[model samples]
Target: MADHHHLHRSTKNRNGFYVKMKFFRTKNGKPEKPFFVKHFKWILWFSLSFYFFAKFLNNHESSTNNNSLKTSIINHSHRALSESILQKPKTSHGLLNDLKVYIYELPSKYNTDWLSNDRCRNHLFASEVAIHRALTKSDFRTFDPMEADFFFVPVYVSCNFSTVNGFPAIGHARALLSSAVELISSELPFWKRSNGSDHVFVASHDYGACFHAMEDRAIADGIPEFMKNSIILQTFGVKYNHPCQNVEHIVIPPYISPEKVQSTLLKSPIDGQRDIFVFFRGKMEVHPKNVSGRFYSKRVRTEILRKYGNDRRFYLKRHRFAGYQSEIVRSVFCLCPLGWAPWSPRLVESVALGCVPVIIADGIRLPFESAVPWSEISLTVREADVAKLGGVLDYVAATNLSAIQRNLWDRKLRQSLLFHDDVESGDATWQVLVALSRKLGRSHRRLRVSSE
Candidate 1:
């Protein structure tokens, strides 16, 4: 009876209230429990309760500390750390769900035959060729269309280069692609089986499936009716209400010759001293024309030339340079102003060579934003803010330039922006697979099993 008497505990809980409890006898009492059996349930209950309470408090405190640490990193002065909020990949999330892709073996006329033009597989717009080449040899590819999660349509539309100008003449793109779709729809059961929703097409050109270089014409034409329901992997994207990108699509980076980027890296290491302050060597016409009621670069190029053309810190040129990739490696900031289209190859080239890209295109949606920290790695100057670019860039150089450079030079980040002949882990091709895996809800195979 004395051992079972209630007592007041001086120890307070988190609420600062003293706890009252009964004392247990260890020695003075008769062995009614045999010191164990009689009160075994209470002892076990108290022990478990204490353990659970301790674990709960520890978990709550640990979670709070972790969240505070993440907040501390984001609020740090190095602006690049602000990427902690963006959905950037902490890991590659490699080959999610064992995703499988099926490549439609259309006649050589639709794909491989175009490779006869050596430039077809190596040009700036050659992603249409590279992805297909890589997929045929990738683990994701399956010859059995029945087990495929998504069907890949390989059509080389950007290969018909004009002899006179050496630029891709894509006038026949719509008809050529239309023919391929017709062949697959009639003979193959896959396209019709899924209503083309599980099929994927690559439009590595100026305006995506609109298939025109001119934006006005591209928008007027719009994504083809046949391709509207299918998935399109394209380079053309804008964060606006544009008809050209109204269909299901993923923004992909334009093709940049990996060999050329590698060659430039060999000549000048990414960590090498950048001699040029600001570099641009593409077409910056002194007098741009309003072709089809659109001025070249929308006068953005001319504005850049007018404002910083003579400034020693800004190196602007109007002519073509073959060794431009080498120059990019030796530059601090590379100008990626809008050309005929909002997207440009310079975005990839500059990043690969460790040059900070000064993007002047407004509303441009970059590729693999989830994998590549675009906001942290590059500077985006709106088209309206072109005149003040000098001040803006100077401020960045003074404030967070090193942080941005550190993010840009990350080898895996840069590799995500270029397509290699083969799929390397975390490369652009692999990133595409990761993206497709997230869209597995669209897989007809999964739907069939669930419904059945």
Candidate 2:
């Protein structure tokens, strides 16, 4: 029986070498050092590592009905993930190509001084502030101007709110921007070196670098000569040729706080218990006045008000509501009609808060098309078809609304639209860097390589 088969002792080694069980008693059955004492350092290392790894995965892995708890976990995860990418070995996606942006430190009047008014950072036009703040703290920010691929000129021109109408008075935009250019040009050689070709500026207002809300006036004003060669990151864009978008530009999403989105998400359900059918809260004029023959919102909003003002299906409100975001989270379809500009903040808020956006802007160019699947996630209704918005939404609700919402809820898409305090991987600022990385041929560093 022994010759046929037998189980060996636990100490048996097939390689004819001693494999010590350090935890076990040694030769004379006398205990060596205690296992816990010997392996304490290794245990501590693993414990600490597992702690961080588990924290990073907590929100993605665990499912719970407590949305507030889920939100808390996710906020923690976002912070941890943001910090990890800066210190850890770099990965491929998000902040791709290790893109570097050198933020120009102008006088306080150009940037921080405007932040004395809290609205400057959170308003619809606050991307001018958000991107600047994100870049200043990011690892991609190079301290040496010589090493920078692109220079960021931070000029906050939207914070000067009109005391009368509460709208930003951008009358000072051009002068301030030109002054910033002049200061940077005289102080640094980078501006003249590339003729501002490698420089980046934010024109997060209605008509981009033209710095006007009125399209006709904006066209007449045109992009400033000093900024004509620079790369503009602006909320304004269009499909057709327009004077405002004449320069090299990248379309950017209007600023909406990520914290605001998260707070709303905490109180909201997973799939969102959307009760309101069609949601619109902003101005829907009953009688749109024509200014220079261009009616308000091209009279599209006026048409909506005339048709659906009393329609119970469409939850329309004309007055201001600070908690409009809460209403957005509970709605099925959010109306993102045009205002002075084709693009609106609701487009980002609706997508971020889980409402299916029904885009009513014509000839509008959306931001981050490379990262965001706009056509798939959002439904576009022509400006002429404002009268049929109800039936069109009804058809979608009956047929493929679920599919659209699923696409809209993709975290990557949402991430690519909002700027956090620090640049998070796959967030809005990161997408900007990704877009800039593709334009490296315009950079001075790359030009030096070509000449060499």
Candidate 3:
């Protein structure tokens, strides 16, 4: 009975060991897989998927935060600009002090009839109107010439010349301009005091300061001699060009009609929605008798047309001013090539409509170059590379393009380009006044030091 019990106990022990070994070991002595190891592939897949999903969520949140921040900043900046515009301009310091200007009330021949005529040459007449409006509304104007920082001679030279049909008629306009200057010089003691250096005039025409006739040189009291020391404002200002070539001179923007300005201001489209890469609508073929030799003579526009005439990316049309506003609103960039002169009204129009301008004019002096950061706002292309305009535009990064668009959309920049009827401190007229004030102040300081 004792032997039988011992054998039974030994059998039980051996059976227990066999069962344990079966679960813990394989036949070749390899360890059996754990619960996790049994579904290793599924577990690994789940872990990887979870990691990726968490990463995606994190990135999404970060992007949302960034977008929100950008929106907040833009809103804040816009609000600040609005508040600043409503406030009166402080003339406590800098160049915009208690500035005084004296405007000459010239005879009807010099001013009234020229302005009354409907056929004004270019909208250069608008400069005269804008300045007059600004003077009337602002505290800058003075009745006494003795207390003035600058004297304004509001002679509508451009308007007078606009009525002339031929080159022979230019002599009559020249005589009128010369007589006006002579009258101002003889009547006012101010012109004699500074040799017209302190006098300001608007000659913002394609022809620099309106001395177009060869006969102007022969006349003793011509526009050229009178404007030698004056602070002349012109449109087509190159460094080497006459009248505008002087250091005291300023390049003013061409006028956009009230209708055009209002339409563009109201109907400006979003930059991202602008489907057309580049849009240009103007005269493609220059007349053989075109005196300026700026249009087809250089072959810039013709070359661009030859290369990109059929390109869907580029929209080049001829004499299509009726749909100009619509086209500019839908275009990402506006091509502003030199027309009769280096400067064109299209440049200012492009900025007003929030279209980044691609300037094709070489040696062109832009308006308010000192105050406006044009290089940051516009793109310059060489005439030789007109054919490669597509590639040049394509190579510009999306980020840079967006930045330029934002600059174009800036309210202050747009306001500065506009001609407001009232004396707004940041409008085109106000900016011109401010520029003149600064220049005059510097000249005064230099004179005082020289005398000392």
Error of 3 at 29 (Å): 99
Number of the predicted model whose TM-score against the real structure is largest: 2
Candidate 2 residues 147-229, lDDT tens each? 67899998999999999999999999889988888877776678999999999999999999899888898999899999999
Q: lDDT score, residue 316, model 1?
A: 84
Candidate 1 per-residue lDDT over residues 106-178, each given as its tens digit: 7688888888889998888899898998887776765556578898989999999899999999999889989
Q: lDDT tens string, model 3, 389-450?
A: 89889876455887887777776776777677776767788788878877765344345546
List per-prediction Cα lDDT, in the order shown: 0.83, 0.85, 0.68
Better by lDDT, candidate 2 or 1: 2
Better of 2 and 3 by TM-score: 2
Off by over 4 Å in 1: 1-94
Please report how far candidate 2 places residue 290 from its true position, in Å: 3.6
What does the lDDT read for residue 63 in candidate 3? 66
Report the lDDT of model 1 for residue 213: 90
* TM agreement with the true structure for every prediction: 0.79, 0.79, 0.70
lDDT for model 2, please. 0.85
Model 3 residue pairs with clashes: none
The TM-score ranking, best first, is 2, 1, 3
- Which candidate order results from sorting by lDDT in descending order? 2, 1, 3
